[model samples]
Target: MKRILLLLSLLTIAGVSAAQEFSGNIALESLIFSEPGLDASQMDDNITLSFKPKWTGEWNDGDDAWSVEIFLRADNRDEGREHADIRELLWLHLDGDNEWRVGINTMFWGVTESQHLVDVINQVDQVEGIDGEDKLGQPMIHLKQYHDWGVLDFLVLPGFRERTFQAAQGRLRFPIVVDTSAPIYDSSDEDNHVDYAFRFSQTYGDLDLGVSLFKGTNRDPQFDLGPGIPHYVQMTQVALDLLLIADDWIWKLEIIHRDTDPSAYQALTGGFEYTFYGVYDSDINIGSLAEYSYDSRDEGQRGVFDRDLFVGARLAFNDAQSSELLAGIIYDTEKHSQSFRLEGNRRFGDSWKGTIEMQVFSNVDPSDPLAAFEKDDFLLLEIARFF
Candidate 1:
């Protein structure tokens, strides 16, 4: 709370002395499940309201800038789903080809469409969803240098934010409640443990490559199921991400090697997306996606991407509304389990937008990792108005 207040104070000070830009949105969301209830503790109704606000200020003729973003949600069904977070609060300094950022910020680094296995800088806001796209703000000092060879990013993270989880009343949760508060760290400092990372990315012709090394607590924690309770086990990870573009074909790959107590393994997810441009000479564009994921671990995989195949499509309607649709299915090859997702969004008028998302799970074995969500298929609808 004190850090949040300090960040707001800085934003106020910056706004008073420089030109400021403010924009954000508020939204109403509803989630409905196909089954009556997944468990005894499941909520009957799923509805929520969210508010997102952003403020940005510029000074020194654009050489320096500061920004803040806050995300808040009020869920009527589950207290765990109702949350507030500082998504970003950072000041940036730019000098020629070098840049520096300080304060809390969010970073995303990966090229795979099905799973972002290489993105480890920020903790996952798990309550947001299982997509692994939403991330919590990470407090850090970051530097970036650009040169002919590539771009180098160095980060010094002073604190670690543990991943969030769903409460008992929340939907789409595991059968056993996760004890998020009890996280065991390899480092004694726990959340205050200072961590560091570096990444080098370059583009050579049609090929783009990135390699990163993180020597700190892992963002994704392994849960220890002892006596029917859960606890986080921290570890370290090294990752690589790459992308290749050839005309209408785009290939993406992400690989990671992790080291944790009692376990060490490597994982990879790679695929290609082919676009059929101007389909039938129409303005619409259609794209097909295929990806495969592999984990060295046989049965204790934390995610659903172990030994799975992902197939999907992207649809873009070049219309006034900027309509788009993305549909995908992740099939567990070994267990014969499958998870499907369909997401669509479009703008409504100048200041409003709407989104609809549907998720389904099928053929999940009782012993599979996704067994908890076997009956948790849900559809989500959201509409937002911009400032």
Candidate 2:
């Protein structure tokens, strides 16, 4: 993987140099724990640094282009977290409204505030954060076509990427470290399995609709403790995502029905966001978000948001600093568990910015899935300088 990434980086750098269109950034991040015993090591340093560089170029009047991004960190707390990745390394060709892309790229789908049930193309960078918002790029041949009916996307994934996991010394992980090195697959070819997907999306007036199908290994891993190791199970999934825009209110819905060997179930996440613009003529915007998530599985489920309600608020100052604040709470009705998160960020001049985030878990029952993270509350600080 290191050799492949190095080669790609060299190629991307060369291409960007030839095109003379280079841009990137330098970022510094620090994580401070509110309490100890979260990870196995309370003696490690609380502050760490990471470096990310990105470059992109285009030719033939923007019809052809290439982009690459590299992430590197200095901390060695968790072997999986303190690593490097080629977040994006793709070549794109455009013809009218149709497009073709080849290489590793990241894609997102779904229209919900709390969870993304229909977004399954890219693997999650689990070690990055617990929100599951960060993703690792996947190698694929992607095609997008536009028509009168809507837009259709066809993806041919030649290789599968294993999901990252927290090591034993990681803070936001279970007591027993999941061994992601030797993952088992249902297919004989293992990581070489060819996964494919199809999606069709359309927008009519203020309503947007999307339907998708995926057939291959599941992104979420299922534990196999019999062999005293962790592995993943293969599954097929079909999903639907919908969004409705009405004035200052937006409604979102995501439903997924999947089948696996041991069990087959359906999951749903429905929500809405209401925003008030220019509140009191102060150039401040406030938005309220409410969502409900459900899973067909009973107790001892693998996920934390099985029967949970999520309520959140977002505040945007819309000033020269570009300041923003977001606060949210997730309440599990079934297990009587709750989690809260606070996030804020602001820009300082044209080339520098900073961010602060905090997460807290409360009222967690022993039987709840989030019980492991009860003591993992933490605060994160990040600053970046753009070029």
Candidate 3:
């Protein structure tokens, strides 16, 4: 992750320099813990804070095209206890339309979310992240353009399949050739250099339809593989990502199959299958979820049939007060133990403002080692400012 940040800085410098604009916020959260095992000796209260800033800049070439962006993030918790994630990307074009991006940015799009700014703020705060040696071997630059109803994007980068396979296991995979003009990826093996995706999207009334046909890199991100796995053994999520949205309904249909190897990273994204959707509101609403993830990374690996069906709700007493709650029954995913949770947050005071919240996690299986958590939980109250 440090290298990623370092690379971002280097890219900014390498490009034509320009003045930039910025804006964001900072927040501090106070908490209290009461875990049964460690509850006896617990802090009455703890503090967790977040900060974020942005970069708004652009570069142009005559009247052809230009790019602009504003990015922000926070990288830590309880000062710097948690990991941080990147968040932000707003682009523009002087002539036609541009829609589509590759690499990490694509991962963000595949998942529906609105907490990117919050994610970036967390990333800035996290000092610990994907171990250094586990970083993506290929640094890619992908883009998309449009013509009528069809779309096109080139996952352009160093060398293709032929050359890449030859250089596999060796550190010299990214070959550089000098030229009198400028250095460019020798697209000679362009065929083995597969053009991964082709998508088409349109709208009708409250319903929207989108189809993506691309060569997807494996499903479960490769970062989970750890540093020991050779880069060549990686998996790919080559399939179609279909999405449809109608009014309060959101559906994500992924048709992905995996290639065999060891560990979660080797399989395509859908190892744990899920297909169910529910909707909520701007402030309060309730929704249900049923999905499964073949999460076999930690020592607590459970077999494939871990299915969960649950309902979650959020409420706001008013503009300044609110609460959140969720409860569910999980099977195989928890055949041995049933699971549940409850949480709420509220704000109070005039001159001295404070936010209070509590969370409880429990397991139904008495024999399950995690059952003790049902009787023990954590509470928090935070007071701070936003500027």
Q: TM-score for all predictions?
A: 0.94, 0.94, 0.50
lDDT of 2 by residue, 103-137 (tens): 99988999997888899999888887777788888
Q: What CA root-mean-square deviation does each model show from the true structure? A: 2.5, 2.0, 11.8
TM-score order of candidates, top first: 2, 1, 3
Clashing pairs in 1: none
Highest TM-score, which number?
2
Clashes of each: 0, 0, 29
lDDT of each: 0.86, 0.84, 0.35
Report the C-alpha lDDT of model 3 over 229-248, residue by residue, as the tens digit: 21222233333444455454
lDDT of 1 by residue, 46-141 (tens): 889988878888799999998888887777677777777888889999999999999999989989988888888898888998888988999999
lDDT of 3 at 14: 40
Cα TM-score of candidate 3: 0.50
| Candidate 2 RMSD to the correct structure | 2.0
Best by lDDT: 1
Question: What TM-score does model 2 achieve against the real structure?
Answer: 0.94
